[model samples]
Target chain A: MKVESLVFMLITFAVITLITVSLFIKVLKNNKNSDEISEEEQ
Target chain B: MPKNEQWGTRVGLILAMAGNAVGLGNFLRFPVQAVQNGGGAFIIPYLVCFLLMGIPLLWVEWTIGRYGGSHGNHSTPFILDKMGKKFFWKYIGVFGIFSNIAIAAYYCYIESWTMSYVYHSLIGTFRGMDQSQVAGFFSDYLDVFTSTTGIPYEAIIFYIICLALNTWILSRGLNAGVEKTAIIAMPLLILFGIFLAIQGVTLTSGSRGAVFDGTVGLNFLWTPEFDSLLNPKVWLAAAGQIFFTLSVGMGSIQCYASYVKSRKDIALNAMSAGWINEFVEVVIGSCVIIPISIGYLGIDKVIELTTTGGLGLGFRTLPFLFQQWGDLLAVLAGVSFFGLLFFAGITSSLAMGTPLMGFLQDEFKFNRQKSALIFGAIIFLMGMPTVIFFNEGVFDEYDYWAGTVSLVVFALFEAILFAWVFGIDKGWKELNKGAEIKVPYVYKFIIKYITPLLLAIVFIGATIRPENDDWSKLSFSGWELHNESIIGQLIHKGIKYNNTYFSDYFKSEVDGVVDSVYHFKGRDYILISYIDEKGLTHTVSYNYSGNELTVNLGQIVNAGDIIFKGFVINRIFYIDMARLLLLTMFISISVLVYIAAKKRKQEKENK
Candidate 1:
């Protein structure tokens, strides 16, 4: 690939990876919070 | 309404939403638009529109869906009724339902084409075929089930199979069907896309003896022509691509969002989905198609193919390139490529159908399976004409109205309702209800003012543009005329030749005639007559090949005196009339829905 296109591809991958990780972290945190809330109520 | 179906998992919901956004357009349509508009320069406007239009609309639709879902309403009409205080606002929401049904009818047929092509590729049907033969293969496939009347059985069968698959999955309810498929399919789509992109860029030789690096194609895509950014057409193209690639304007996004919990982090999810779609489109999509074509056929041939519309590259041109590979490798590559397309097509097609399914279940309280089956039948029956008569312009008509015009109209309505009617403050709060990151405050004005202004410009500019007005015009080689009837008038006066007629007519040569009936067989013709700005009457005829003939009327014919022949025979008029009638029917239905809603309100008040 051309240098420009290669750079574009790398940047895109980096952005997607960042977003995916963030989403997973948020979901995990939300699940943990819900579990803790339920335990406290019980 | 079955306690308002909710997504089983956050991951599954995001995957399904991403699958909805990532579609055939990502691979096929995006690269072509990018190359045609301004190559790498196109990305500037594209990203600008993504921020200004795509992301904002994504958040808007998600917020609308979640808000409506909280109130036991999933479809657009009821969703808008909740968002907008006035009764007339729900009537405006009717465009959403109309667009989804119209789009799904043709979209399902296109999805079947991918499935059929996948099967064909696996069997090596396109192996060893030349370019013309490959083109002929696609043409012949279109005619395979064609008949004089009713739907072709071949098309009907494939379409039924496609619809049945979608219906069965949708009927499985949210978690088991759409979500599961998305979780599986979206990952495979990305993997397949990466594999193809790698293979495309690694090519070392052309089939016809050209030696080149695949980076040449990459350079062609990324190298910017700065001048094109100044054109309004490029801006519109960028906005349109953003809308299509993100699958924003179609009520599908909102429908999927409706299944999310009201307090879910819609802002981050919407941004992630948008970025995922853009990754598939710009990085993977641009890498796969252009590099492969350029590596196999050279840059010149690829440029020639790009002018023929993006679908041509996917359907006709790339199949020929696949034939140039080693035997086992060729088969493997062909199957994988087409299979990726099939997965992409099915995911998006399913999203198109889901909103209507939501409507049936939420509003009418129909069972999920029953609604799925009924809508499946409706979509199948509606798609029959396009399947049977695709070459006769039925598909194009549906594509133009639903895919192009209605999308913009519905999107414009959405922007207006969210920004102006719902109040930007409320919309922004809804968007950030459970957000992981806050949206920039500048978008407050952008969504309220700039987004709708941009959409209105696109809509109004498209409407006032005369180029699309002449739906009947067969072709134009020179001297642009807006309508097709003028060409029919030229044909009536014995202008039976092409470009030579223009020279001959201007020269006043009465005897310079070319007998070319062989050229005219099986071709649609049109006559056009117009008075020039200088008050001189000119008449012309042409065919689909862009051949033109200028007729000499012997004496000066006045502006209204021009007579047309063969123009009335064009099938485009019938399609236009049908579209007009369909719009009329939608308006009437909108009025009835308003009355019904008012009556329900009255009944509740009396009680």
Candidate 2:
């Protein structure tokens, strides 16, 4: 890939990682009480 | 404002979006502009805009629209209020309303031309005319129609009919009018397109000449002349075409998406329409524009001839070419061609009117009927200039200001506001919910970066003011050179379809493909070459023989027999490699990410 494209991919990876982390953190906070149901179901 | 009780169904919302996106931009502008600005080269930037610009902007519109609808508000200002922006940005909403109205005004008038052509073609008045004569006929018709007492009556009558139909549908609300028309028109357009493709093939058999001449057909389409590509003017045109073609940033889509339920997936729908539009432009559109142009102007001058004017390129040129080929086949092709055009014009015009009507109802609290009528009246009255003057200067002005500049600026502001101000995270939650396919993490990546970058490039590139051409210049850059060849050739060959008449008059006299050996046979032909795995070359002749390809291989050809072919040799099969790779990458990444995230969640729960 060209330098420009490589840079774009890096930027994309960073953005997606940040967003996923943010969402994951939010999901954990919102569903903290539901963790017992998850473990029991498993 | 009324509650969400009157909004469109999911299907209605999809249709409204499709209706807005798939208008004259697809049918009228794309084919002409693609040929004019270096065919395959033009697609490069266009694809970039779609991948980077169009999809993201659509997502922004959908997110904002659904959010605002839940609160029952209209456009940028209403939505921004909740997003914590001050009243100053409400100006964007007002600007959007003006842009839509301006677009509709001229769009309706151009739409009227289709109705007029349909009436003329159906009545057999366009039959048996040479180029100049046909040109004269159109000019005379325009003169008679635009005069205080002239053919403007017919134009007005149809204009009102189309306008009333639009208003009546909008008044019926989204499902009854907008969605219904989209579903019906979409199918009809496809069916009619198939019919036109069928007719186009049949026209290949008669005496016209080499139908595959690239001068206007495939050569003008795919042949890359790098000089044209490198020109800043070409890039500007490509940017302008992308902006106009997708209907992005127009509030046309935002207004329609406003009616969509929060759960309905806007991104997927927008992508679907965008892909369909690209397919039609490259495949069906190229098939029509190139073959017809090659048959008339030859390969070299095809570019020159098509560069005259966008409307003149397809509307005036193709009809005259059909007349020249003269026969039962020609007559059928002529009717199908115009019918296809009429369908395209109507679908697009409806989309243009939607945003105008929506803005009025949302901002001013006008009922659907009142909004539709008042908006429709304004469009009809404004369209008068295009109808009455018969000059492209006014049309060009409207197209430039409302179609390109205003639309993109609005779209850019929308993207910025959605991604940064309103917050991208909220959009993700709504988009992900109930998606049959799990939302890939990369979508977030695209939304934040790829899409915004593309829009910025297209918007900035499009607004680059031309240094050479004055805004007031009436003459198109390439018009004189192109039109001269057309007139000169028409004068030399007086007959429309009679090969004997043309050959006798112009034989040994003209320079282009007209003097070549292939004149009488309608120039649409196909040459198929297959190189097998064993290094054996198979050359075949495929020509339109009575509405079907008559394939002669000079060897035994068997159906359902395993003929081991080593390599697929067509340009058609090769060009799709990049898009296929991108699709695969996207799918694979999404799947892997989803699986990894699910597993991580399971581990965390166990802990």
Candidate 3:
């Protein structure tokens, strides 16, 4: 594969992966905190 | 919302929302769209639109949905009514219900095709078949008359089975039904997608009848075309793809988000869902179809294949391409591909049902069971016409109006309602209420100004798409309405069927001598355009086949002479009937919303 295409693919993929991963982690973290609170109450 | 219908887990809720967004469009539609709309550089406009339009719309839907849910309103008609001050907003919400049922009717039909294909794959029906035989199975399956698959009415049977399955699942209500299905389906969808992508990318050029390396196709997909950013059509395609891929414009996200609890972070949830859809579309979707096909057919052949039809590439071509792998691998590939599609499709179709079910349960005193049954029945009744009359362009008619036009129209109106009428300040507050993460402040401006402006442009561009996709040629001065515009579509602009003649007739270039005239097998449209002396072109359109005309087979016709003229409306009746059916569906749903509103008023007065 050409370097240009490889760089382009990497950049695009990395950008989307970054966006998704960050959000997903936050969602999981939020869920964890919510769960912890409910469990503590219980 | 139902007492039992709230999210059992945040993970389940996120999975279901992601599942709703990450659908067949993410895999099947996006790959074809990216390749056809300037390949590698398409991501530029795609991501731009995602920020400016897609993610913003997601927040809007989620905000409004939770707001409605807090008010005990689950469906769009009531939800929109709760959000917007105007009386018409509730009526405009009819698109949410109408588009879904109308779309679900056909969308489920496609989901059935995936299910049937999975069954066939596991049964090893395609084990010994060559490329043509495997490809031929799709058409043969579509022909309800043909018993080639040894099952009579295989298409209809699968469709019924699919609908029954959906009804059964939906009948279980939120946690057991949609959330459980999402938990099962979404994980498997990602797994299958990853498996296929791995299979695609690792493919060797000469290992198993491949003409080129799989990585070469990846290169073709990601190689940037910096110039494509300048083209309006490319930007529009990216916008449409973003709109559809995220599944925003359809009221499904709103319906799903409406189930979220009060004080939960809709902002983060919406962002997560939108980004997950992008992950599916950009990474997994891009990797599978094009790479595998190019691994076998070469890039040129794959590019050429796109011209036939996007649907054809997925259904007809992929099975055959997978056949290049031997028996075991082929079957596995087929199962994975079709299963992922089925999962993707069902998730979205399941979302389609929620809005209607929400409408029924919240409005009428229908239980979840009754609502699911009624929704399924309505879909079955509405869907049968498209199934039975597939050849009369009825299916395409439903897709064109409800699937494409209705979604855009609904989205545009909702954006206006959210930002302009609701006041972006309050809308922004609603958006950020109970948010887990800080949404960028720039989105306030984007949601208010950029998003709606982009949607309006998309609406106009879609409603009156320029002939040949060149905006420079958009002329409204009685130039024949032979485009994708609503008016053009209403007239069934140009003969879409097999037998038709359409071309520019340059009178000045032609000697007045008679040229050869040909006979049409059937239908309306032998549109002949000729330029006048003043350089203005005049179009003479006629349904010559429907009339007794002087034009005959092998007859000579002079330049600028209209050989045939009359109404060439072959399936215009079906088209009109289809439009009427959609209009009726819209009106009927709007009536239900009105009655529900009135009932709510009466009950409140009594209280």
Candidate 4:
């Protein structure tokens, strides 16, 4: 691949992957926190 | 709010929503769209549209769904009905239900091809076949009348099995049915995607029988046409991609969102689903078909194959390329590739069934199992023409109207309803109800203003596509319609230089009742269409139009009788009939909605 093309491809992929992973982790953490809260209430 | 049936878990809900958005388009259509609409430069507009249009629409659809679900409504018709006070709101919602049923009809048929390919892959049907022979395998499958492949009525059989599978899952209810299937399928889909993408990027020129470097294809896909960014059409193309790719406008997302529990974080959930689809499209989608195909066939052949469509490239070409990897690996590649498509297809098709099932259950008091069966039967009936007339133009007709046009129309309406009609203030509150991640405040203005304006641009750009795709050069001085434009498609009016395609035949209005059509041509033929008392019909190589030798067929045609039968080439009635069938289906669904609302009114009065 040309350097410019490779750079374009990498940046696009990295940005999307970053956002997806971040949102996924945040959602998981929120779910875990709720489970802990309910467990404490129990 | 989530009274009837709720998603089993947060993960399941997200997966289910993701599964709905992440479909065949994510893997197949996205790359082709990127290639056609300016390659790497396309991503800028794509991301911009994602923020301005796709994400905002996702929030709005979810807000409408949860609002409706809170009011004991789960379908688009009743949801829109509840959201807006006007009666016509429910009618606009008809696109959600009708488009699903119409689209599901042929969509599941295409899904069946994936299942059949999986079967063929496992059995090694293409083991020793050459290129044309491999391509012949697909054509044979499409020719429903023939039974060359040992499976008699092969197309119909697979279609039944696919529909049955969808119906069975839908019958299992939302939690067990859609959510459970997503939990399993989405993960496996990702795995297959990752595996195939790895194989694609690692492709060497001579390694694994690759004819060219796979990385070369990646370059072709990623190389930006900076010049194309200056064109308005590129932006419209990007906007259109965001529109279809996120699977908004179609009632499927709204129906899925309606099941989400009240006070659950819809904002985060919608974001997760939308971004997951984007990840699959941009990262995984770009990695697979185009790279591998270019690696094998070279970029020139790959570009040529795209004219047949992404489905063609994925189905007809990929198998032959995978065959170069030797037997065991070829089988694995085929199974993974086709199996990935099957899961992607089923998840989306399953989304289509929900709004119909919701309508039946909430309105007519049908149970889940019964509703699933009815939905299955309706598709089976609607799908038959597309299956039998697969070679003819019936399938494309359904896809053009129901799948493409209906989606844009519905999305436009929903955006208007959510922001303007329902009041953006309430809709914004609805989006941020639960205590998860707070949505940024800028979306408040974007949702109300920017998204709808972009949607209108997408709509106009699609319908009245400018000449040469140059919006600046567009002029009304010598205006001529492109056959592909919406208005041109509606009336079948355009200057078709090629006579190979069927729907290209212009359906003409009655001018003088066709005095006579004289047609004879050696090299090329121009189809001149005119209407008589009977209806639409066309003539090729007529004396009045283009062509040298003209032979009048007045003696064969009775003077008093209608000269033409409103048909052309081979698929005379089927194309027109397909349009009629979809129109009838839309009206029928709308009628059902009206009757459902009336029954609800009666029940309330009695109470």
Candidate 5:
């Protein structure tokens, strides 16, 4: 691939990966928070 | 208010919405559209439309769904009635119902093709087949012209299987069925797309005179023609792509959103789904299809193949290219690729069922399982014409009218009702009600005015442009004029001047040895035999366009004086007329129904 095209691909891949990872982490964090609140109530 | 079903989880909702948006279009359609509409320059209008049309419409649909759901309105008609003070809005909402049912019928049939292709690829059916034979395989599968298997039993069988699978999934209810399938399928689709893209880019050298790598393909795609941005056609194409890729204007998004909790954060979720879809489309979609095809067929041939549209790229050309990778590797690649397409197709096709299920449950009080089965059966019956008459323009007719035209129409209705009649301030407040990210205040004005106007323009422009008319004819003409060899051959063969006109003399030149004649609309085309200076015989044809004859046969001429004529013929075909009349009748009847219902309701109140 051309250097510019390769750069473009890498940038796009990184951004998508970051967004997906962040979303998953957020979901996990929310789950943990809910679990903690239930434990406190118990 | 009726008790509405809610999504099992926020993650499931987002994934389901994303899967609904991401489909065969993301992989097969976007890359071809981008390349054909001036490559990187296409992105300018594309991004513009995404901001002006796509994002705003996503918010509109989501907000409408949540708001309507809070009040026990899951279907568009009920949702629209609740939003708009007038009953006419509910009637306008019928577009959503009609569009979903109409699109789902043919869409499931297409999904079946992908499923069949997966099985064919897995079993190595494409192996050892030459390009012509590979092309013929798909043609025969569609039973176009002549059937290779004597009957279209395979098509019917696979189609029924696809319908059953979709119905079974949908019958399982929202969380267990659609959401669960999307959670599995969407991730696999992305992974498969990425894997194929990696393989595509790594292909440095190709066989069979395809001497280029993936870079050539990427360059072809990313290279921008700045001038093309000025063209209205490019803008229209970009806007249409956004509408299609985002799955906006269809009532499915609203139906999906209705399943969300009334207080859930839709703005952030909508944005997330949109971004994910774009990532799949622009990044993975472009990365895989274009580069791989270019690596296998060279850029020129890939470009030529793309002009034949999505089916040519996905079904025929890609399978042929896979076979070029030798034996075992070809089978592996073919299975993975077709498998990816099957997943993508099913994910989206499942969404098409949602609006119907929601409508039935919301209106008739049918249970989810019963609704799913009845809807599936109706679609199976409705889709029969497409399968039985695969070669006879039935599929194209449904696809063009229901899938393409009605999408824009319904979207326009949505924008107007949400932004204008329902009131933009109210819509904006609803959009921001459970938002994680704050949408800019200016979008309120944009949603109210600009988006609707743009959609109106697109609707009118598409109406004016003839369906099935090839826009590339002008480009071909321009290319022929620029090429010395082609122009020289034409001049040498033709004894006279080349201009756009229909004369009886030119018609007489090919009348003597005419082999066959076909009539389309009011025009007669004659195919005649001619001999060159080398004594090689060939068949050439000319079209009679009522007032003039325009011939642009690429290289069919052997020897004869032929004058090429161009004229602006605005003749409407029967299909176009029927489509226009149907749309007009639908809207008119809707208006009449609204008025009659309103009168009856008012009388009841007075009594």
Candidate 6:
């Protein structure tokens, strides 16, 4: 039971991390070459 | 002087609000509930709520804030007017403020629990506490926590400390006060949480593998327990989990959003905050609670402990587990765990305070400092019952009424008001104006259909059923022992049964399981069936002798042994799916951003 619970939690972490990282990476990639916006635009 | 100010930056708003949204409940309640409910299975509903409802509602609140802009100070009234229902909802705006005030009172009392634990740890009071002793200590601790005749000095001190901390930050205004705290505290929380998780997993018992293949550990947590899901308890828990954990339906989110720069991307930021909140609150929290519960109490006890008497599981059960680790380790674990808990509570209290602070400033036009202090005093007074009152479970009532039911209803109301009535067209313009990345049309669909519908169903399920009051009565059988006198023990050795081999084989399979099973009468029997070494099916009745099972075989059947390999495969599949979906969303976003960047670059080059 303990093993199963741990594996599940680890898997959950992995999933959340993967999604978070992926989304983050996408945001980074999209914004990587873009010019910074002025304060007015922001 | 500048009326209400925008957050100096988005990051601070995210942190402060996130800090408020994430709490001890998430860290404390979520994992225990997951562990006991079937680990992976619970994650299914949890993740569903996160994506479908939590994020979208966040977007709704943010949209309201940014669209109203300077006028957003009066969130409920402003939105109601815009939606052409100023009369009805003007009063409802107070719901969030009222809930925050009520919650703030009890929140301080609860936060003081951490202070007590901190003081006790430093004094080494936990050095000799066993499970029962620890429970007794907590009961006694509450006596000092809540004063009967007026406010107790100790309670006053901590209450003052919490209120002072909140007031000082508000005086700095949003940038210096809320944002600065969020940036520093949120990271510390994550780091501390990660450090504790590492320590917990490294412990001797924690690293050991699971007990059962299905619905018991990793697989059980994710694997859909359709049977359990069908029950109202599961649905209600899932709803309450979403409501409380997100810190929604309280106007808190709206208050924070109100300060956001008009051009900031509501959808993206909301998604980011919601995503981060769930990761810290649900995922990391589960990491801490599950392994510890499984290591100490076994799977079944994890369930009972989770469902035990409101939110006292963290205070009562965790201390007992800490004691089991012996003196040095126990003290260290107790200090570190509770220390992490303290920060989590403080951050949440700060977050809850923001909405109330905003409402006060907006409605009454008081400066932030004065508003925070005046409201802080009110919450402190209201919190006395939660701290001092023992019999009525005042804290639990506050948690259920304001935290659970009220939050869900308010959240639903907010979503509908924003998406349908307030006009998504205006919201879209506000969200996309300065957004570096445009929100997809899909966000509109989700805010309109997906988010509202999901919340409604979950709310109905959560409120329609009576909550489980006595979750402690549940128990599981591991061994059968007859409690007899020394002489009577000898006489019970002659007890007979039909299938004796079942007990013997079962005992042999498990080396030294705990004696959890108990017999009803002097002599009680159980029927057991399994395939033998030759792959022939057999049935037997077993009479438990002392802590042993004596099986009596009734038939030697010739069917092959039932295969459990499929259940094993299904378990792996669901876990992998959850992981895949989470990763896919993240990766897909990254790839799209990359493509979008390339497209923009090409356009720039041509220009």
Q: Could you give the C-alpha RMSD of every candidate to the true structure, in order shown?
A: 8.0, 20.5, 6.2, 7.3, 8.8, 18.2
Instruction: Choose 1 or 6, whichever is better by TM-score.
Output: 1
The 10-residue segment of model 3 chain B with minimum total lDDT is B504-513
TM-score of 6: 0.71
Candidate 6 per-residue lDDT, tens place, B151-247, comes to 4556557666867776677667777777887788788888878876665555454233323222233334444455565554554466567777888
Give the i-RMS of model 4 in Å. 1.2
Instruction: For each candidate, give its TM-score against the true structure.
Output: 0.82, 0.67, 0.88, 0.88, 0.79, 0.71
lDDT of 4 by residue, A1-42 (tens): 899999888988999999998998888878776556546644
lDDT tens digits, residue span B196-266, model 1: 88887776664433256677777788877788888776887898888888887788888888877776688
Query: Quick one: best lDDT, which candidate?
Result: 4
Worst 10 residues of 3 chain A by lDDT: A33-42
- Each prediction's whole-model lDDT (CA): 0.73, 0.55, 0.81, 0.82, 0.74, 0.60
lDDT of 4 by residue, B456-564 (tens): 8777867887555657656767455556678877766543322323432333322333344433322223233344454534343221233132223333332223323
- Give candidate 4's whole-model lDDT: 0.82
| TM-score between model 2 and native | 0.67
- Which whole-number lDDT from 0 to 100 does residue B599 have in model 6? 55
Q: In candidate 4, residue B12 scores what lDDT? A: 82
lDDT of 5 by residue, B1-607 (tens): 1134566666677788989899889889999998899886787788789889998899999999888888777778778988987856888777776777777888888889888888888878887788888887787687633445444478888899999999999998887898899889988888888888887777777453356787788888877678888777788889989988998888888988887666667887887888788888887888888888888778777777786587788888888888777788777778778778888888888888877677667655689889899879978877876787655445766677778877898899989989888888888988998676778888898999999999998886665432222334344334222111223322332223222222333423432355566674355665767664545555655555543433343324333444433343211232243345446645653664466456647876999
After superposition, which runs of candidate 6 have C-alpha atoms over 4 Å from their true positions? A1-11, A22-42, B72-75, B83-85, B145-156, B206-232, B323-331, B466-607
For model 6, the TM-score of its B chain against the native B chain is: 0.71
Per-residue lDDT, model 1, residue B516, is 26
Candidate 4 — which residues are off by over 4 angstroms? A33-42, B1-3, B494-572
Candidates sorted on DockQ, descending: 3, 4, 1, 5, 6, 2
- Per-residue alpha-carbon lDDT of model 3 for A1-42, expressed as tens digits? 889999889888898899889989888878888777646754
- Give Cα distance to truth, residue B575, candidate 5, Å: 4.4
Q: In candidate 4 chain B, where is summed lDDT lowest over 10 consecutive residues?
A: B542-551
